[model samples]
Target: MTRTFRRGGTGGAGGDLDLYQYAYLAGGGLRVAESAVVSLTERGTLSLGAARLRVTGEERPEHPVELAVVVACPRSKPVREVIESVGHSSEVDVIARRLVSLGLVRRWRRKPTRAGRRRLADAASAGQVPAYALRGPAALVPGSARRGPLDVHPALGDLGRALTRMGKALDDDRGHGTDSSADAGGFGGGGGDW
Candidate 1:
């Protein structure tokens, strides 16, 4: 048996909203078992376990930098450099603070050598920023292998279809002005809105 999944954006603020597709194949039998879309909007619909639900709430920032730091694990680069590299200039301090609070990264002062200390003293006299390293995770490194369930039961087809419908309806209600039904063919017409 083999399982396949695809992820894409659902078109919203910062293009952070996303949609997912899950399908399973076994002995030449192919079935789509799930379709879900999540957004940072006020109200949307979701299908879960034979239930169609209307969800409403504020979307919170997930601090995407944390993931970037994780992927760059074992490399403790400077915080300012990390922010610049990740293009999070405006939220640099906030993201750094959040990551430190979550224990995902550690900030530390670089030990100064004799010559480095002289330069630091000169820079301090000139009011330059202090240097710090944003460390990555200690236990789990990127590309580490892990295992989990491969497929959802074929019996959940109805639930999958329901979820697709809800997603389409929500998209339509948002006036995105695109027909996602045609795109979501395999999951019974609950395709995503780019």
Candidate 2:
């Protein structure tokens, strides 16, 4: 977990990154997108509901991720579609590349570097980020996580439920193959004729 830096890059992007970076390092692009949505809707800049997300004001978001969400929803669009689209858009990719250059993430495997991990840990400890966000995508993987009530922002109750449904749909799409032969052999070499 130790990373040696060059002469000037000691702090790894000026000692620490902002909250959005922490969210991305903790989970992925989706986490950042979700956080932005919560913040925007809470401020009344955006209206997020189960069916649609609409921009209500000209509130230009400070974060690139938030801005991307706004751009994606120029008109009233399905909340699920907007969140997923913005989460996987070019904005997140740009942030990923920057994290790599800053030595906060490995280029290929895409795991956090030492500094990245420490930053996220510190942010989580300080309550700057949510515990669920720190849990990464697993926390959103539908049945994998209990369908308990989420204590989210008042304006984001819809967002929370939408995210849950989205995760369930993704989980279902991964494997609904009931045929015994479809996934009979475990994904291990030992299951083969060894």
Candidate 3:
């Protein structure tokens, strides 16, 4: 399957700033190509084999659940590390289990060594420890050029930004409460209404 996405407009005054894209799947599988490109547009169209797909909606705030998956999707990591990286210990386990059930990740037991057992004695349960590994497709979605331990594909950068924005928004909401009407408008003295 070939996936192409195109985002509309250039960033400038009076130009639309919203981002949009389409992802298509064809013949029940994705193909790897050196020159493959996926373009995303504000009003983009997607074609998958003989089927056409359309996606529409306002982007929702990024949740920890999705962030956890993205963080753990690139490689096999110790369960504790995955939990720590996402900072959602309780939720990460559930998400990992679900991913395993969904066939997106695989879970296995790693027998604890003497040193490992000592290090994790306080943190882990008896016997072997559980670890998770991303399935081929989940890891390959980021492409072959992805680098570093924490790097995600360029295509997923927007999602990372959304997660950051959501964290800031939640922090602000906690500090100032949910009502933001006070800052709804600014400048001039006309009650700040436009």
Candidate 4:
């Protein structure tokens, strides 16, 4: 699948993107590739795989979830460093897990597979670790690079977008609290208006 993308968001202007051409754009099973490229600015113009998606929030802020990928990609830093930078958050953990599943990253405890070792060896032979190995924030846990960005499913994009929206909505709603004083019941705080 191929996807064409033009970037003009908070991340600044990015080059036109084609998922087929750049599978790295996606991470995990979230989503990858497309039959055609669509400008992310055009809402409802893009269809991920078979799922229909609308790019509603063009100017919406970049979600922490997105940053999670950035942190794990080590193209930024080591895994431990990323965790330290982002601090501990369930959200970050979720993103890390998803990233790991997508094969965008590897945990440290696992052994590298033949292919992984071969790739490492190849890099050693080349006298330089490829950017993918050095730049991307990956733990390289005992596992093989069996999966790459191409392995990410396109639907994951929708999931990421949805999670982003949900989180933002919650944050927005938090500012307009409407819960009753007694609604808290015994949870340890105020309750609803009861």
Clashing residue pairs in all predictions, respectively, total: 0, 0, 8, 35
Which stretches of model 3 miss by more than 4 angstroms?
1-62, 66-88, 109-194
| Index of the highest-lDDT prediction | 2
Candidates in order, TM-scores: namely: 0.17, 0.63, 0.18, 0.20
Between candidates 2 and 4, the one scoring higher on lDDT is 2
Candidate 3 per-residue lDDT, tens place, 66-91, comes to: 33333342443332233234433444
Q: How would you encode candidate 1's per-residue C-alpha lDDT over 49-164 as one tens digit per residue? A: 22223222233234333233223222433322332343332223443343334332344421223433333244334433111111111011121111111443233344334434
Q: Report lDDT (Cα) of residue 10, candidate 1.
A: 35
lDDT of all the models against the reference? 0.26, 0.64, 0.26, 0.31
Whole-model lDDT, model 4: 0.31
TM-score: which is higher, 3 or 4? 4
Off by over 4 Å in 2: 1-13, 131-194
- Worst 10-residue lDDT window, candidate 2: 1-10
* Stretch of 10 with least lDDT, candidate 4: 28-37
- The residue pairs found clashing in candidate 3 are 5-38, 5-39, 5-40, 6-39, 6-40, 6-41, 7-40, 7-41
lDDT tens per residue, model 2, 126-146:
665654456643364333532
With candidate 1 superimposed using the best TM-score fit, by how many Å does residue 114's alpha carbon deviate from the native? 30
Return the TM-score for candidate 4, rounded to 2 decimals.
0.20
Q: Give lDDT: candidate 1, residue 91.
A: 29
Q: How far is candidate 2 from the true structure (C-alpha RMSD, Å)?
A: 7.8
